[model samples]
Target: MNILGILRDGTGKMAVGASVAAFVAATCLAALPARADDVTWTMATHAGGHWLEHGAQGFADKVALYTEGRVKINVAQPGALGSPLTTTQTVKDGIAEAATTWGGHVQGIDKTGAIVGGWPGGLRPEEWFFWVYEDGGLDLIKQWRMEKFGVVSIPCDTGETEIFLHSHKPVRTIEDFKGLRVRTSGAWAEIAAKLGASTVVIPGDEAFSALERGVVDALEWAGPGQNFKSAFHTIAKYIITPGVHYASGLTECIINKDAWDKLSEHDKVMVEVAGRLNLYESYARYGELDIAGWAKLKEAAASGNNEFIKLDDSFIAAAQKASNDWADEQAGNNEWFKKVLESQRATLDKLETWDEFRLPIGGVRE
Candidate 1:
């Protein structure tokens, strides 16, 4: 009683009570588990050996690392969960919590997907990376996916300049592309068709077999980094340079809305962070690999039957016009596509500021 009385002047008593309350709260917090959410979400990807699959595991690992075991990403076996073209559908269907897939593959569902996949005459890897994080590009992608697909979209993997075509014939003119049985996807397919080329939308995994079986005369897959070993060098007579179909490559992670909604804010952030980091890493890793891959292809060409066909500047100019025209047509058909394309173009336009400050005129032309 005396000890209580000693500390119990009304204000002192109030302070003592507050301290007791804080102690109880601290004890309750300490008793709780460390992870607010112990969620392990499954992510679908292309088959095992594919770059998308490689990046899927990398992103998953990064999420686990950032979340400190609170969140785990369960990456599925190659083609076991979804195909390159169907992974987004798998996520939308709730078969997988998320998928790492090219947005262009889903262009059949919505024309805008092609723009998100980094369309022809669009951003390069570095510019795309900058726009995604700094500008409102990421937010726009998230918005579009949620609004249209009922899923969450994260830009997980971004890299590669892309090989123009692994072809059995040389292509240096619009006439060269015309009537050519080529395998490609997304907006490029549409543009190629308009250019009079017969374009088949085959998944990358099947591209090699199709080329071998004469199902398609040529294919445009990743840059030399992956193309060198994709067996294209062995089968194709021509390795076209400066991917005019699409300058940069971008792949998205489509998350099931339910799964994403369940994650704690902290977990959500870690997931986004992991995807963002994966983009930068892929860009750097592939940049280096593509350089070496180019050398490898050249060396292989010296002995093997491969030939590097740099698309004529005039033809590239034609492709650019066609790409811009395709974008305009698609934009007219779909408002979402129009909006996003405008935003992207605006970003590219802003980069024109570099022109004013250029000490030398030696960089990317388009």
Candidate 2:
């Protein structure tokens, strides 16, 4: 069925007659993958609510379109297939074909997971694009996951800068954090402790009650949009600024190795392409949602219910030092963590050269 070889050796013109054309079509059809490469996958996810649900659905839609319906992904909510913490494990164990997961949820299994999720003073969401697509980080993540965890990993979704904290007590300075009780998650709790804050983890379902009942003085969950969804603004008196804990965050889509192996090469690439498209698209759209949420938060501020508090700029340097020290400790603890850390920092250094030369656009952001 080597049609090209037969045509190359034919003693005739390159133009195909009707019989040859029909024969070539038949050969191509026969050469294709079995079932015409049609595949359907359940995309189990750790995220059930907020913009992430939309983002996951968008990824599924894109996969179908990019593969021309040869592949289909049906996204499932958290606990639909398994619990949030079990998402990656489900994919790894082949109990699920794929999952979109927050790496922060798996830090116990791999400390590097938290780094991938997001850490204080790390690369922003835009910076992640350079590191992943241009700086070979994608290949490294893929190789590491396949070798160590038996899954295909793609940097699939990103969230923008989050709220620093919703505080009952105003955090106007670094000192204000001293003895401040906060309910938070991920790497931020470690940094918060260094800032003299008492950090606690409360169940997400009870976070509102915790904040309302003075169980925790402050809470930091996500950006404005998600925070609004959780109604933190309704109770906390102070909305802190500059989410240094996580300037942004990354989440991955993982596929079972055996399930991925069943895909044709073209469809595999299409999935990756769909992931890349959704990564950028989801981040931007989420930011827009945050902007609208911020507007509503502003109205609440104007009504004398809550105050918008910007911590002194000096807190930035203190946070940066603490975050870097914690990151170094992580790098020293694991090889994969060390590699990704070096790659991200090195890429940021290179980008910093151009960033320093560019003129500011002259907004508050400058």
Candidate 3:
């Protein structure tokens, strides 16, 4: 005992013993075998050559990186495996291991899907994120997917504000919407129908031909960049601003339940992280691309071939009123819809107070 005390106090033998123990533990850990199996998944998307598709590709790449190439994903362009409208079922039935789809497309399957996807006079992309991530929205989404579609859902991408109405005729007032044939979907379509406009549901790829053939007098399809990419300006001269109908659209990565369950815990987390990263990357990229698109539109406007019109405040107010009324009716009809809609509305009310007091960042242009 006297010799032990002397070594601890003067010889530093205790520190040497601790170091040796740490080395032994490290060596034992290093001797364990690593996970050796590699997994590759196939994912189908609802859109081809759009920013969302680009984001899907990014997710695949990032998943591989995060999983150290142990997990890989191959993304199929829109309609590759099945129609966009049927993608939810396709993923659920294991026709594809995964799918990237807008929530509205599956509303017919479950009304709750449209509310999560988007709603008229809805929260913007940033606000939607807070509701989904910070609030209990994500859990509700997962629950809904599991019960309704037998899949795991992750919000993977978000679109910017949609162009309210690309019209062949100028719509300057709420009254102007009467009898206006519009191509739209989800709640907006229902709201427009309530406001006396005839609404049609068509695939985005068919929008151009529909407009050209006079199948619809007006249509909404994404923001400036995507609208430009679709050459909407060439067909519809009046490009409406401030897309109130759909302020933002949320897209999701839907994975087959069995496939997702088969993934290791680490690989599952990597997939989730990749989805969130894609949301931010896609939003930022769309912002940059839209700026370039607006410049081109301005040039076209200078030649008197196109015009950007701001929807009248009164018209927007009326639309909001109709939207709220329709939402209430839907909530009345469906319990699950009511749960999600009320949650979102409550979140919006809480955010509105803070949003109103924030100072405007940039000056109004003359």
Estimate every model's Cα lDDT from 0 to 1. Answer: 0.78, 0.77, 0.78
Report the alpha-carbon TM-score of model 2 versus the true structure.
0.84
Between candidates 1 and 3, the TM-score winner:
3
Highest-TM-score candidate: 3
Ranking by lDDT: 1, 3, 2
Model 3 C-alpha lDDT per residue in residues 70-120, reported as the tens digit of each score: 878898877788887778888988998888878788788677777888877
TM-score for each candidate, following the candidate numbering: 0.86, 0.84, 0.87
Clashes of each: 0, 0, 0
Q: TM-score of the candidate numbered 3? A: 0.87
Alpha-carbon shift of residue 119 in model 2 (angstroms): 0.8
Off by over 4 Å in 3: 1-34, 361-366
Write model 1 residue lDDT over 218-302, tens digit each, in one string: 9988888788768788988988888989889787877899988887655566567667667767777888788888899999889
RMSD of each: 11.5, 8.6, 10.5
Please, what are the lDDT tens digits per residue for candidate 2 over residues 132-227?
777878887888777667889988788888899998898877788999999977777778898899999644545689999999999887888888
Question: Which is superior by lDDT, 1 or 2?
Answer: 1
Off by over 4 Å in 2: 1-35, 202-206, 356-366
